[model samples]
Target: MESKTVLYIILASIVALGIVVFQYIYKQKAKSKIYLLLAFLRFIGIFGLLLLLINPQFAQKTYTLEKPNLVILADNSTSVAENGKELNNIISKIKATKELSNRFKITDYKFGSDLNILDSLTFKGKNTNIHNSLSALKDVYAREQMVTLILSDGNQTIGEDYSYFKAERNNTIYSMVLGDTTKYKDISVGPIQTNKYAFLKNKFPLETYVSYQGNTPVSVFVSVKMNGKIVHRENLKLNSDVNFKAISIQVDANSVGIKNLEVKVSPLAEERNIKNNRRSTSIEVIDEKTKIALVSDILHPDLGALKKAIESNEQREVSIFKSSASKNVLEDVDLFIFYQPTAKFKQSFDFAKSKNANTFIITGSQTDYTFINNSNIGIEIENGYPQQEIFGLLNNAFTKYDTASFDLTDFPPLISDAGPILITSPFETLLGTQIKGLNVQQPLLSVIDENSSKRALLLGENLWKWRVQTYRNTNEFINFDEFIGNLIRYLTSSKNKSRLNVDYEKVYQGSSNAVITATYFDEAFLFDQNAKIRIQVTNKEAQKSQTSPMVLKNGYFEADLTNLVAGEYEFIVSVEKESKTAKGTFVISEFDMENQFVSSDNLKMEKLAVNSGGKVFYPSQIEDLINDLSTNKAYVPTEKGTENIVSLIDFKKLLAIIIIAFTAEWFIRKYNGLI
Candidate 1:
């Protein structure tokens, strides 16, 4: 189509014609028409090949009609369907509405613990999560002109408040409120809060919140039960119609294992729903104290600070001593805190290593790099210089454990030597180094896993200043105290160097689906899928047990144990071939999340609809909902135009034509004895 292309075509044709005329009918002539036919075929074949090399494009236009989406998101949890017949009738009317079906693409989703696409409701979910349901609706209808209809009681037993849910799209939302809004005469026990661990023979405090709703004065008794036996009891009086009171009681830990404790509030007269009258929890009891030996060369404030922080944990007993005091005390310790190891303390360091104790080495201005370099502690200072002030930079990629709730950027600078270090092991850096407010790619706090040992290194000193600065900014030492506590917990915990490792929470709520995950390693300690793992779970009190095989998933093994009831359970994980074993205990507490409250929250639903530019309707107003959807101008069908392009070089028929033209010319010349 361009003039340049036309000129190229003419030139190719002229060259092709000259060759064909001379070759076919030069002084000795064939048939007159045969000469013209040969030249024409030759020109066509050559010109077609040249055109193909140009690689042109062909396009086609198409039109599509897409109806706007009418999504009906239903809460399938048990609370929403307390009145089942009424809910079913509302659903039937919405489904049978002919006007909605004719105008939009209607979709149904049932959400509770999870979301599913089904035409009917079962109402078997143990919990209702309104926030998650709305979030799922936004994700499922992202690209459509969506009009979402929600049907729920507005009772969120889990997740955050849905009234604060921000819409992800410019879609309209309408809600049909369910459940009775009238408050009933009830007494309930809220979630219990207490310490997770207690030392043997020590009494730990437990706090429980009691809620009452009634016009009459109520007298309720709160009791704590351990292993189905009452340990403590108290009585309280409520005068207000709706009031909440926190009851405190102390329980003694006499045994050393996982102790199952239950806190219950006596139900009042004429109380029909008694599921929320009680809640259960579990606490771990340890008989042996965690002995932490802090060894230093001098009496500095940093030494005193370390001892004070570690002792704040009631379960730990910290002992301070000089590095040269004696090696006898190190024999019975579980953890060693070494501050600024020098050449003179080489023997003390060797003695700690010989006993296979977990060690935390703190480097400072007085550290002897040459002595530490040859200690085989998985860290080496490559070069040394004068001291520098560097702030702590947290490593976002650290996955060994969770960091405490504190901002590392605001902490004061720590003093460390201006030197480079070489870490020749598998390490995770908890905190990196920042100089002059610029982050440097170096480790300030790191952990190393080498040769079946756990080690930690803090590459700076003057950690006392961090505590002082933290208190000045926040008016409290809670952040600094928690950071140090978490670090000690990580160091003192047992390291699982076995070929098979099982990961599960020590405590689970009954309202959730409990899942256990595991990993298998080969002889080289790398993850291997070919290994087979199985687990046998036993109820400690019931004396009943069941074994289940784990299925391989995403390079690990997993098993679902959501069917287990509330009780203390012990699990044994084993590999049949390797004859390895791992044992642990987990407790499932009675959740009672849905039964905590039954009244509907109509105000929340009203806010949701108004904020999203729509109207709220009661369950009986389903017909009105259909009429509003049909008449709304924004919820109309959409038309889209699409254009598709294809390349000429990809046309197989064109290539075949070019090939046949050349083949026919060769055959014709051969038949005429001009080959």
Candidate 2:
């Protein structure tokens, strides 16, 4: 079929018909029908030339079906701010341009705290989540051949990994990075937990953390201050790999209430940011010490020695229960010690009546060897006692000794003729290494009843002899009191009662939506219910949940970080147990990577041009682009090309000319020409 350009060509045909009529009228005296026909043929040629002027071409079928797809994408996270660049606000600025809107059939999307089509935009959301926004893009344009435009700060806080977004691209993705990238160091102090109030005068553990870039510097001093006065300060050296530094401080709090604790570290010379060098935490001080119960056999030197030893150095409540005499005592002591009970095992259970107290059983100077031989304490004495003393094992989980002086294997096996005592079965051996216990010839102190829940400390020789023999070295053993203090500190220290630590010292703006990650190592860290985490602002009292159904991921258990507010929030994250919860304090700060945003020197719209399959030209060369697009799309319409037949018939100028020629023809023939 022939193609026509413009309704003008059709109007030309009407003019040609009028020419045929005019020729017939002027040559009325000579009957020239062939001349009129030739004139009509010439008019057709003129109309054909006019079609050529419009420059029509056949629309090529590139594929079986022409499917046009449109993709809409936007930044959904809070970190998209362009730092000082102010480029994020340009999204609104660009919308005001009339030229861009008129150029294409557009679909718009916006993201801030959540994914949404950008019918409206407000500056009130918390932060942006990029992963969810991308997923929304996939869902909305799933079936279309799409070109996606992403507006973000490149700070992605969601997704298993971020490389997936960058590596694989099934569709054309145009990234319009909204922020500039730069570096800034910030330190912040989180909330302090004052609930399980700890106050033991001049020193208590004040937990806080330090955040710095990797390998930034070393040799910084950290100080703890209370109420505008400095209390404790320690010099510290740092490594780059140590992004976090959690230090337990010795603080002095006189009484209970809201008290400010300032954990300050000396600023590094190269530390570009110094505002976060000092962190402030709050605490409620209460005068309380750990409670201890000691069950001794009779009045001995060890009591006075222990009392003075514990009193001068340690902080604890000590109650002496001479089990051979009294049965009545105070309830709910923290630790229970049974010292060579002359009475019997009945007193062991009686002293442990307070369910909360931890039990510690010691070998006595006159341990009922006859009864112990028949009982199951994991060790049994020989019928004829060995002339020499021996020591065998030296592992904390297994044995409690610095070094083995005398091997217990030379004495006798822990198993008696009755049964096994301090050891496991006759078949099994418990050792992480091959240095076996000397049980082959004669086993020493072994864990007989493996069900021994209470940790036992066994000594082969009566260590009281060492206490008496200490006068030899006046300088070395000058202070016999110090040795006993170390023993008591290890025995009574509530190291097990410490909290799982979460610290927030420094965070960048880009890392705002990131989860507050912490480091923890439980001898056995496992899952439990009734676990809740409370995060409050560093200065303000606002709390949110950090609880997740699952506490572990990739071997490390984690608490969820969703629905958290922005700013430096102090967090009292805790794991609840049967008695008291293990708690740790940390700070969480909103990171806006756009805070580093800078104005780019290169403003070329390469991404915008490529995604749209258009070529980018300098501002001076934009005319070529506009002209080319207009030239390519100009006269092309419906049938994917020029509609020749419709154009030929509907030309208005040609219709008016035809009507005038018909009217003149009718007037000449009816009134003058034919008559």
Q: Which has the greatest TM-score?
A: 1
Per-candidate clashes, comma-separated: 0, 40
lDDT of 2 by residue, 1-675 (tens): 234433555665676566655665455444566445445454555454454455334433332332333344555443443231343344443444444344433577777657776765553345545556666767766655454555555554334332244312344554454443345443433333222345546445667666655445567777777766888777765666766667765666566544556667887766654655665545555555656666776666666655555566436667787565344454656666666544465655554643534455554445555554554444455433332344344334433333222222222212112222343333121212111333332333332222313333432324443344454444233244564554455455434333354533333222344354433444365432234433332324554444333255553345455445443344444444423223334334333332222232123234443544434343233345335433544212222333333332345655455455455555545564453
Candidate 1 per-residue C-alpha lDDT over 136-181 given as tens digits, one digit per residue, 9 for 90 to 100:
8788778767888888888887788988788756678888888887
Off by over 4 Å in 1: 1-31, 39-59, 84-89, 119-122, 214-219, 228-232, 239-242, 256-258, 270-272, 289-506, 511-513, 517-524, 527-529, 551-557, 645-650, 666-675
Residue 445 lDDT (model 2): 32
Q: List lDDT for all candidates, in order.
A: 0.81, 0.47
Score residue 341 of candidate 1 by CA lDDT. Answer: 81
Predict model 1's lDDT versus the native: 0.81
Residue 335 CA error for candidate 1 (Å)?
A: 11
